[model samples]
Target: MKAAIIGAGPAGLAAAEVLSEAGVAVTVLDRMPSPARKLLMAGRGGLNLTHTEPLDLFLSRYGAARARLEPAVRAFPPEAIRTWCGGLGQETFAGSSGRVFPRAMKAAPLLRAWLARLGERKVTLLSRHAWAGWDAAGGLLFNRPDPEPLVLRPDATLLALGGASWPRLGSDGGWAPLLAARGVALAPFAPANSGILIPWSAHLRDRFAGTPLKRIALSFGGRTVRGEAVITAAGLEGGAVYALSAAIRDAVAAEGEAVVTLDLRPDMTADEVARRVAAPRRGQSLSNHLRRHLALPPAVIGLLREGEAPPETAIKGLKLRVTGVAGLERAISSAGGIRLEELDEHYAFRRLPGVFAAGEMLDWEAPTGGHLLTACFATGRAAARGMLRAMVG
Candidate 1:
């Protein structure tokens, strides 16, 4: 079988790895100058390949998409990822947070080795090939952003274009429109694992802008995330904020604004906080007292001051305004893409036979913590398996 895999991110490359190993001659076409721009970007932060945790707990991270994606995940879970990294000569270790990393602790070295392996496997790569939808008579077409066109045909095709985030590095969610044009049902792409845009007060912005809220807990709806948040010039952007981004995004879209609560001190109890605040202080400034008693970072202080002083009763539960979510271009990942209903168990589009989709291109959003890459790799392999199954008969 011959395979043409599009977008050389984790999913596309994973598909190429699986199909080629299955004796399928594969050609991976990418719009980027090189493969895995997002993967390379991820590696900059120590290349968290997957998480080191039990299967069930880890699989639950996908939330609503869990059942639909379970089989693939079970087949290619985090342990499999660590094993694969070992095969690539990058030894792995689990972080204190349970996120796995390469011993090299860098994405570049691992990627360079992975690319070398892909080359050893004889995967033909065509870089700078912008996919221009399909040509008449049903074949692949390419537009190099020039006058001429490039065309290719294979026994099967897999489209692993990433979500709309990071358009500058490609995966511009442009594939959504193209696939929709080809009669594929697509979910509206919304930013996920992204920061929420808030109306920061001028004083707050000036004082705490670019500050980090350390050891903080953010609450929205009924859930709480314990991590650090960074106060950006525009608003708040950080891991904890991103963990709640999907809920916040939908809430703001539905209600125009969402109120999120930040537990300025998640580790301590409100009673503990209040008790500390009640302590006698001789001519100490409020900032110094708060700083001394609670150790609240300047960012948390600014956050607390965003609204009227919480009555001492409300000091522990302070609300922050999230006006909107960061734009897709600024998001870390996206929430919406090809709806799962459009694909069968094998991840092949029901409407377009011989065409498979995987990775963030599919309509699923997971928090960071290696769940994103796990699904991408799993779906890529699943799509390849689907194509292989179809060809065998």
Candidate 2:
């Protein structure tokens, strides 16, 4: 049997591996000149493969889509991902944050090894082939630089085109209208794992545009995440802010803005902060007092002063108004795609037979630190299995 996968990303490539191993001739096509550009870029700061947290806690990171992705994740969980990496001669290690990474800590090595293995299995990779819906004869149409588009007719096809984020790296959500025209249900794409836009004062924007607020905790919508964030010229970005992005984004959509409280000293209690703030200033400026007593950095002090709260209360709960989220071009991933209800358990479109989808193309969002990649790999494998079953039956 021949199978065509219209994407060369983690999901499409993962599916290709599964189908090829099952004796299916798989052809992996991509719009980019090379495959897995986003994966390589993401690895610049250590390629996080998966998380080692307990299964339940890990699954909860997916939020509303937990139930839909549970089966695939359970079947090909973090351990399996590690095993797969090892099979490619890339050993894996878990960091202090419970995030997994290849021993090389770079995606290029892992991707290179993966592609070599796929090549050995006779999986064909056609670059610069952008899927453009279907031809008159129901064949897959791919637009190329040439005048005529390329056409393919495989026994089954998997649409792993990613959501509309990082368009430069190949997942521009261009496939949305194509599927929507076919009468498939879809949710409008939105930013996921994106930074929050805060209108910083001219002083803060000019002086601390790139400053890092380290060892801070951010709270929004009753949830708190402890990590670090950087002050951008226009807003805040980084791990801590990204964890609460979805809540903040939705709140902003409904209320025009969202307030996020930053705990400058997460390790200390409110009373401890108050006590420190009450300590004698000894003629030192308030910034010096905060620096000496609370150990808050300059950026944190600037941020605290931006709010109307006094130093004592602001030290523990300095609120910042988030007016918007970073656009899809800057988002780490995207939320909302083909709605989950449009796909059956097999990952195949209920209305478009023999055509399946996996990865970010589905309407699910998760925080950083490995949740995104894990689901992509898991669902890709699951979709391949479903396609195989469909072919047999």
Candidate 3:
């Protein structure tokens, strides 16, 4: 059997490996000049391969999509990914935070090893071939830079085109319209793991645009995420903000904006903060008092003074109005794609037989810290296995 895996990101690559191993002649195609552009970019800050947390707790990171992704993830869990990396000559180790990374601390080495293995398996990788849906004869149409588009008739096709984020690195969400035209159920694309946009005053934006608020807790919609957030020219972003992005995005969608409560010092109680603030000032200025007693940084003090300084009890509850979410181009990842209802348990499109999908193209969203990459790899393997089953049956 022959299989064509479109979009050479983690999902497509993983699918290619699985199908090729199953004795299928596989070809991986990508629109970019090469492949795995996003993967390479993700490693700029030390590639986070996966998380070492317990299966149940780790699975919870995917939020609403946990149920849909459970099967694939369970089949190829974090341990499997680590083992796979080891097989590629890239041993992985978990960090203090439980995030896993290859020993090389880069993506290029792993990708190079993977691509070499693919070459050994005789899996064809065709770059600069952009899929343009199908033609009249049910042949896959791809538009190259040249005049005539290329058409291919493969036994099975897997569309792993990613979500609408990091367009320059590929995954521009251009596949959504094509899939929608084919009567495939699709959910509207929205930014996931994106920063929030707040109408910050000019002073705050100018002074603290790149400032980091370390050890902070952000609360929204009765949920709280504790991590560091950075002040951007437009708003705030970081691990914590990305964790709560779904709730904040939904709240902003339902309403005009969402109010996020920022806890500058989550380690201390409000009463403790009050007591500290109320301590003997010794004729110190209010700012100095805050700095000395509360140990609040300049950025925090400036942020507090941006509007009205709340009482000590309410200090931990400083609210910021989130006007919008960062655009897809700026988002780390995107949410909403081909609705899962359109597919069977195997991830094959029921409306289009012989076609399967995996990765961010599917309607699912997960935060950073390796969840996204793990799901991509898992789903890719699952889709390939589904194709193998179908071919055998």
Give the best candidate by lDDT: 2
As a TM-score, model 3 comes out at 0.97
Where does the lowest 10-residue lDDT sum fall in candidate 1? 307-316
Tell me how far the alpha carbon of residue 387 in candidate 1 is from the true structure, in angstroms, after superposition. Answer: 1.2
Clashing pairs in 3: none
Off by over 4 Å in 1: 145-147, 311-315
| Candidates' C-alpha lDDT | 0.86, 0.94, 0.92
Each candidate structure's TM-score, on Cα atoms with residue i matched to residue i, is 0.96, 0.98, 0.97
Tens digit of per-residue lDDT, candidate 2, span 262-295: 8889999989888889999999999999899988
lDDT for position 273 in model 1: 89
What is the descending TM-score order? Answer: 2, 3, 1
lDDT score, candidate 1: 0.86
Report lDDT (Cα) of residue 172, candidate 3.
96
- Per-residue lDDT of candidate 1, residues 285-362 (tens digit): 776777788776555665777755553434577877788988988898888899999999988889997888899998
What's the ranking of the predictions by lDDT, best on top?
2, 3, 1
